[model samples]
Each structure stands twice: as structure tokens, then as C-alpha cells.
Target: MDAIDLASLLCSRLCHDLLSPVGALNNGIELLADEQDPDMRERCMELLSESARASANKLKFFRLAFGAGGGFGDEIDTREARTALEGLYGADKRIDLGWMVTDEKMAKGAVKLLLNLGMIAGDALVRGGRLDVGAEQRDGALEMVIRAEGPRILLDPKLREVIAQGHSGGEVEPRAAGAWLAHSLASQAGGSIQLNDPADEVLLIGVTLPN
Candidate 1:
């Protein structure tokens, strides 16, 4: 990937992840300014604490996956990666994780690719569902598949566009930011994303990474 494109992608990712907790912090401050009750103040403090922790964990995970320390030429720390994934999704027991591949270090690009795919799968499951994430080495390349199965699948059209084209410069009519980011990351990693739109149920995302 070109340096300029890579920089833009990283900036986009940073802005996207930081917005949530930072917005929560702002809301907490506003509540503190208007509320005088002791109990309410305690609740606001708790909100702030939770938001801070969530933001920190996200940054830690992104840093390892997107930063220079982790890359194609370097070995990823599998333990750290698993811990980060758990931090991101383990809080809710709704989504059961099925790992088909061995716990081994992967390329940094592969790590980011898989994480983004997982995020997409999670988004498809609005009412909670099962996510099966697996990786395999095939034909001198690495292939990753994320299967999301739920009673109802919420497929955003804008996200479908991003996954198919790799870029979209328009108003955010829906929650397609995550899909756009996933497309950018996949393009940078010399990979492509394929979605299976079954007529009945389940949304499957397939990503292939060049080794």
C-alpha cells in the first residue's frame, strides 16, 4: 500500500474507534454539570470509568494490529491478540465464538483483516447470534472466513457497496462506517471480501489474504 493511503486508513480507523468512548465522556461531563444529586454523580462516575476502560482496551488492540511493531514481516503475539479479541467481545455471552484454526501467530495484516471481518459479522447480528471465525493455509495463501448466523440478519446496503467496491464518498445514510473501514483494510492487505447472500438465512463473509 502507498504511504498516503495507509496513513489515511489509519486515521479513519482511529477516529472511528475513539468517537464512542470520547462521546460518552462528553455526555458524562454534561450530566455532572447539571446534576447535583450524590447518587446521580456516582452513576456518572461509573459511566466515565467504564468508557475509559473500553477506550483504553480498544486502543491497545488497534495499536498492536495496525502499528508498525506488528506487520507482515514480524511475528504477532497470539496471546495478546486473543486477549484483545476477548476484551472486545467477551463481555457479552450472546455471541458464541468457534475457533477452527490453531492458536498461532499471524501476520499483522492478517490480524487486522480478521478483526475487521469479525466486526462485520458482529454487526450483522443485531439480535445476537453465533459467529464462527476460522483461518487456514491453502494453496500457498491464507484464507479467513467469518460466518454469522442469527434469526434475523440486518444487511446494510451501504456496507454491501463498500465491501464490493472498496470506497464510498457519500453521506452516512446508515451504519456503514465499519464496512468501509473493513474494505480499506482488505484492499491494503492485497485481499478481497466476499459475502454470501443466501435467500433464507445467515450472512457469510469470506476473506482471502495473499501470503
Candidate 2:
């Protein structure tokens, strides 16, 4: 994909993800303005707070995953990526997170790839589940893994195709932006991605990027 098309797709994906929380924020504001009951107003305040938090978390995540976030640096603090993921996925408590990254910092490309994979895996847990993420720099390469296990996993075939392979034959869709980003980053770095076939209750993604 060309730069312009890729950017547009990423932007579309970001807007779609943020629409719900942002719309909630607007609704909360409108409700708070008209409500006379103190209790109802208090509840509105809570809704606004939650919506704002969600919006922030999603922006932070997309910033790092799809934009030039983490400032000017070859490596980014792993803590930032962890916080972004936890903030985005841990808010609802729908999916439990198990983090086992051993590196303090990793290449920015690696970090982006890792976050995108985590997001995709987490979304596959249709019935709520566990998301385990790990990364290590060894043997002169950065190796990362994201595993999702739940009662019912539903990974879209299009996403699977984009994640395992690039947009080789057809136009790229906005929903596949994240997957495309992951695949592109890996390929650009002379790396590779491995995706396990969809099974009863698990999805596994592994990436290796040479340093």
C-alpha cells in the first residue's frame, strides 16, 4: 500500500474505535446538563469520567501502535506499552492480562508490532479470556508472542490473512489496518510472523525481528 492509503486506513480504524467512548462522553455531558436529581447528576459524572478515560486510553494505544509516538527514539520504554495495553483492555476487566516482557526497552517497530498483535488477539476473545504477552531480546533478535485463550475465539478470516501475509492481491480495508501494520513492520525489519490456525479456544501469534 502507498503511504497515503495506509495513513487513511489507520485513521479510519482509530475513529471507529474511539467513536463509542467519545459519543458516550457527549451523551454524559448532555444528560448532566438537564438532570435535576443529585444522584442522577453524580451518575452522569461517573459516566463522563469513564468515557474520558476510555478515550484517552484508546488514543494512547493507537498513537504508539500506528503513529509516530514515543518521541524520537530507536527504543521505547516497555512500561509505556504495558500501561497503554492495560489501560485499553484492563478497564472493563473482560480480559485478564499476563505480561512477561523481559526487556526494559525495545525497538519502536517491535513495540508497535507487539501492541497490534495484542489488540488483535484480545479482540478475538469473544467471550472474555486471558491475553498473555511476552517479549525477549536474544540470539541477536527480538522475539515476541501474544496468546489469547477463551471459551469462544472468533478471528476474522480477513484479519488472519492480513496478519499472516501482506495485502498482496487486493485493496486493504480499514478494519485490517492493524493487522497490515503488524505484518508490514515485521517484513520491513527482515522479520516474520507466525499465526496458529484457529482452534477450539486459542490464538497464538509469534514474531521475530532481527536487531
Candidate 3:
């Protein structure tokens, strides 16, 4: 697909993901306005706070992964990326993150690729699991590895195709837009993405980019 097409797909994905939390925010507001019981009103306030936090977290993640975040600098602080990932996943407490990147900073493209891969892996944990992310620079290249282990993992075959081959036979779907973007970033950086056998109990994704 062309740039415009890919952009539209990403936008659709973002909207779809945000709709639930945003809608919850709206509903909480309405309920708060109509409720007279102090306990119920306090409950609505809690709901609204959670929904607002969710919305903000998603936006922060999308900005760095899919938009021009971290300013116009060529390199981005790894700490910022960690915070973004934590906000997106830590808030829900469904997945535990173990970060192992020793570098203080990484190129913008590498940061985006890493975050996208993290998101994909975290989502695959259908039964709530552990996600371990590691990165190191060697041989004038930046390498990243993300592993997801859970009771049940359910990664879409199309996403695997996109990450491995940069396209999924035909047009890319909105849900796999992040994978597409990750593939594009890697390819643009003279990098490659590798995935372990899908049949394996754990999901492993590795990416390498020339530095």
C-alpha cells in the first residue's frame, strides 16, 4: 500500500483501540452528572480517572511508535521509550515487562521498532504473561530481542507475515498496522526481522539494524 493508505490504516487502528476507553470516559461523565448517591458518584469519578489515564497512555505510545515523537532528534532516550511502554502495559497489569537495554539512547527508528515489537508481543499474551525486552549494539549494528511467554499466546498469522516479509500476501489490515510499520522501519534502516516458529509455546521476535 501507498503512504496515504498505510496512514489511514494506522489511524483506523488507533481509533479502534481508543474508542473503548474514550467511550468509557464519556459514559462516566454522564453517569456522574445524573448520580445522586455519594458512593456511586465516587465510583464514577474513579472510572473516569482510569479511562482518562488509559487514553493518555495509548496516545503517548502511538506518538512515539507511529508519529514524530521525542522531538526531531536523530536519537531518542531509551528511558522515554520504557516509560511509554510501561504506561501502555503496566497500567492494566496484564503483562509484566522486563527491560534489558543497557544503552542510554537509541536511534529514533530503532526506538520505534522496539516499541512496536513490544506492543505486538505484549498483545499476544492472551493469558497474561511475561514480556522480556533486550537490546545491544554490536558489530556496528543495533540488535533487539523481545520474548513473550504465557499460558496461552495468540499472535495473528498475518502479523507474523508482515514482520517477516513486510507484507501479508495482500493488503495489510488495520489491526496489523503496527507490525507493518515495524517492518517498514526495519527495512528502511537496512535491517531484518526474524521470528521463531509460531508453534512454539513462547513468541520470540528479533530485529537488527545497521547503526
Candidate 4:
């Protein structure tokens, strides 16, 4: 597929994710306007605030992981990427985050791969779990590892296939957008991405990027 096609797929994925929060925001606004009861109005306001926060967090993450992120820099601060992940997953308070990335900086593409991989792993924790993300730079290369542990984890079969083999041979879908994006970035950089297996207790996503 060409750049436009890939972009379209990613956009579709983003829209799918944001639709819920945006719809909730709209619904909350409508309810607030029609409600006369103080308690009901207060609940609507809370819903609006929550929807707004969720929308903002997802936007921030997509900007960094897929957009220009308001810069032309080749490298971005690792902390910025971690904060984006925190906003995306940790803010919900369902998934506990364990950040072990000690590096001060990383290539922008590398950071995108890291973020997308972490997002995928964290999402696999179907029931609420712990996600540990770690990265290190050594000998002119960067290594990233993400582990998700929980009572139950389910990585979709299609996503696992895309992550393990790539989408070169099959049609890319919106649900596989993140995995495809990560694989594309890694391929461009001559790096590697290791996917998860159904037998494993903890889902692991590993990557290595040249420096």
C-alpha cells in the first residue's frame, strides 16, 4: 500500500477509538442542557469532563506516535514518550505501569515503535493488569521490552499475525493499524519486533533498533 492508504487506515483506527469519547462528550452536553436537577447536571458535567480528558489524552498520544508532534527533530526525549503512554493507559487506573526506560533520548521513529508496542501489550491485559516497559541503549543500538501480566490476557489472532509476520502479504485493516505502523517503522530502520504467544503467562513485545 502507498502512504495515502496507510494514512487512511491509521486515521480510521484513530476515529474508531475517539468516537466513543467524543460521542459521550456530546451526549453529556445535551443532557446537561436539558436537565433541571442539580445532581443530574453535576453528573453530566462529570461525564463531560471525563470524555474530554480521554479525547485529549488519545490525541496527544497519536500526535507523538503518528504525527509530526509539532517538530522536525530526529530525536525526542524519552520522558515525553513515557508521559504519553501514561496518559493513554495509566490515567484509567486500571493498568498499573512500571517504567524502566533509563535512557534520556531516542530516535523519533524508535519512540513511536516503543509507544505502539507498549500500547498493544497493555491493551492485551483484558482484565486490568500490570504493564512494564523498559528500554536501553547499548553499543550503538536501542533495545525495548514490554511485558504485560494479568489474570487474563488476550492478544487478537489477527494482530499477533501482523506483528509476527507483517502485512506485506495481506490486506491491512483498521484494527491492525498499530501493529502495521510499528512494523513499518522498524522495517524502515532495519530493526526487529518480536510478538507475543498465547502460551506465555506474560505477553512480551521486544524490539531492537540500530543507533
Candidate 5:
């Protein structure tokens, strides 16, 4: 992998992760300056605290998964990965997380591959669903799979094209942007993404990350 390309990917990942909390902080401050009620002030504080915690958890998760240190050149902490996945789910989202891998450090490439796959799975469930994620170490390599099952599976054609490498940056629909990004990241990491058609009320995404 080219160092410059890797650096660019990491930069994009970091910027994406920080936007949520920063936006929340700005909104919370604006509300505080205008609202005068004591109860409302307490509510704003709570919002700020929740957003801050979410941001911190995401950063910690990404540091190990995408940063230069923490097993990038070696194996990743599987326990930490599990915790990070759960933390990203948060309390508001109604998604279930499942694990089927041994508690061991995965390679840096595998970590990045899984993170992008997780983003795809999370995005598939708009009205809420079960996100079943699993990884198996087979023949000294990792094979990851993410299954998104929900009532309604919204598949965007443009996003599908992005996953298939048929399109690049364009005025694509916003709802499918996450999956498109996931596809792009996977492509950059020397991995492949497979999205099963909307059949049997399930949207399955399978990825293979070469070690």
C-alpha cells in the first residue's frame, strides 16, 4: 500500500468521526446562550455530555482500528474491537450486535475492513433492525460477514453502483452515502464488498479482508 494513500484514508476517517460531536457541541452552545430555563439548561448539559461520550468512544475505537500505533503493523485487540462496536451502537439505536470470533488482535488491514463493513451494516437499517456481525479466522486469515435484517430494506441503485466500482464522486443520493463510503474504503484496503439483493426481507453484505 502506498503511504500517501494510507495517510489520506486515515485523514478522511478521522474527519468523518469528529464531525458528529463537534456539531452537537455547537448546537448545544447555541441553545444554552438563548434558553434561560434552569431545567432546559440541565437538558442541554445532558445532551452535551452524551455527545461528548459518544465522540470519545468512537475516537478510542478508531484509534486502535485505523491509527498508526496500537497494532497497525501487528495484531489488533479483539476485545477492544468488540467494545468499540457496541459503543457505536449507543442507547438510541435499536440494533443488535453479535460476535463469533476469538478474542485476539487482528491485523490492521482486517480492522479497517471490518470497521467499514460495520458502517455499511449500520446504514442499512434506517427504521431499526438486527445487525449480525461475525468474523472467522480460517487458514490463518480473517473472513468477515455482516447481515442486516429489517422490515424494509432500502437499496439505492447509485450506491450499489458505487459498491460495484461503476461510479465515483458525484451528486448521488445522501441516504446511500454511507454504503458508498464503505465500498470506497474497502476498495482502498484491498478488500471486496458483496451486497445481496433485497430478498427474503434481508440485506446481507459479505466482505473478505485478505491478511
Candidate 6:
């Protein structure tokens, strides 16, 4: 409900995600310093590169997801959102993305909703299945849909509740910050976020914002 709390939560979430890759960077540097074997040295360098890339990807994704990206404007290029998401999950090579957006420009808050909702749905794909992100104008409203399907899907009960409805005055946590933000933004725009009842293999997230 407050900007300060939301900022702190998002910061914690970013730090939590970056920890592994950044820690890998440190370990890789230490290994490189101690290794003398040519093959081991090469492996260390490779590890360093991989860790750096991972760290960069996470930052890029967060920049768009949680920050006022590129400017102070109310709208942003939709392609940027797609690229940010692809950067975040593309390297893993597990989940396949099906981007079905046709709009060139979208309200910044709308794009943020899509990005965060996509992140939550994608996380549910424990086995890294398919993620389909689609958005368009319908009946003078902007509709965003994100569907995640995999062999096994696991969604946190609290997250499911928070995304579709709200915290209901409950305490906020770092992991749910994105979903919470999406919900808040949608409400501010006189819109609502929704979630389909989880099936055996699929989870669906949807949002609609006023024009």
C-alpha cells in the first residue's frame, strides 16, 4: 500500500535472485586465481562468463519489471518487455516462450503487469514447460493473458491468493512483491488481476486495465 514498503520488498527480491550468480562470480574468481592447469583455467574462465551473463540477465529483467524503465513516460515499447523476459529465461533453455503480442506501445503499468504476471506463471512451471504471453485490445480495454503449462506446476498458495485478489491486509514478503505490485497497479488503474483454478498441468494468469 506504501511506496517505501514496496521498494524495500522489491530490493530484497532482486538481491535474493542475484545472490547465486554473484556468488558464483566470486567463486569463479577464486578458482581462477588458484588454478595453474590450462584446462582448469579455461573452465574457470567459462564459469566466470556464465555467472556474469546470468547476473546481467537478472538485472536487465528487473530493470524493466520493477523500475521506471528508459524514461518517466506513461507508456513504453512493448518489445522491450518481451526482450526483458526472454533475457531472463532464455539462457536456461528449459521453458519455451510463445509471445503473441501485436501492440507496439502499451501503458507502462500494463507492461509491468504483464512482465510480473509472466514471471509468477513461469515460476510455477517446475519442469520448465511452455509459457504463452498474449495481449491485445478488446472492447476498449487492454487484456493481458499469461498461460503456463508443464509436466508439473507448483504455485504457492499465498501467491495465488495475492495475485488474483490481494493480501487482505496481511504481511508482505519479498517473493510476492511482484505479484503484489501487479495487483496494486491494476487496482490503481481501475482494473483487476485474475487467476484460473490450477489444473493438473496448467496455470493461467490474467489482468485487465482501463483505457
TM-score between model 3 and native: 0.97
Q: Candidate 3: which stretches are off by over 4 Å?
A: 70-72
Give all candidates' CA lDDT scores.
0.72, 0.91, 0.91, 0.87, 0.69, 0.88
Worst 10 residues of 5 by lDDT: 171-180
lDDT of 4 by residue, 87-178 (tens): 99988899999999987888788888988888888889989899999999878888889999999999998888878677866688887888
Off by over 4 Å in 5: 1-20, 33-36, 64-66, 69-73, 164-192, 209-211
- Candidate 3: C-alpha lDDT: 0.91
Q: Model 6 over residues 1-211: C-alpha lDDT tens digits?
A: 6789899999999999999999999999999999999999999999999999999989988998998877738788888888889988778889999999879988888888899999998888888989999999998899888999888999998888788776678698899999889888899899987787765467887778778
Runs with alpha carbons beyond 4 Å of true place in candidate 1: 1-10, 29-38, 64-66, 69-73, 92-94, 168-192, 198-200
Candidate 4 or 3, higher TM-score: 3
* Per-residue lDDT value at 168 in model 1: 48
lDDT of 3 by residue, 1-211 (tens): 7789889988998999999999999999999989999999999999999999999999998999888775649888999899999998999898999999989998888999999999999999988999999999889888899999999999999999888888746777898999999999999999999999999999999988887
User: Each candidate: how many clashes?
Assistant: 0, 0, 0, 0, 2, 0
Question: What would the per-residue lDDT of candidate 5 be over residues 1-211, giving only the tens digit for each residue?
Answer: 2345445555676677789887998899899899999999999999999888888887876665556544346667777777777787745667777776664877665665576567556666777788777888677556778787877666566766766672465544433444455565577667787878755478777777665
C-alpha TM-scores of all predictions: 0.73, 0.97, 0.97, 0.95, 0.74, 0.96
For candidate 2, write residues 19-88 as lDDT tens digits. Answer: 9999999999999989999999999999999999999999999988998984739888999999999998
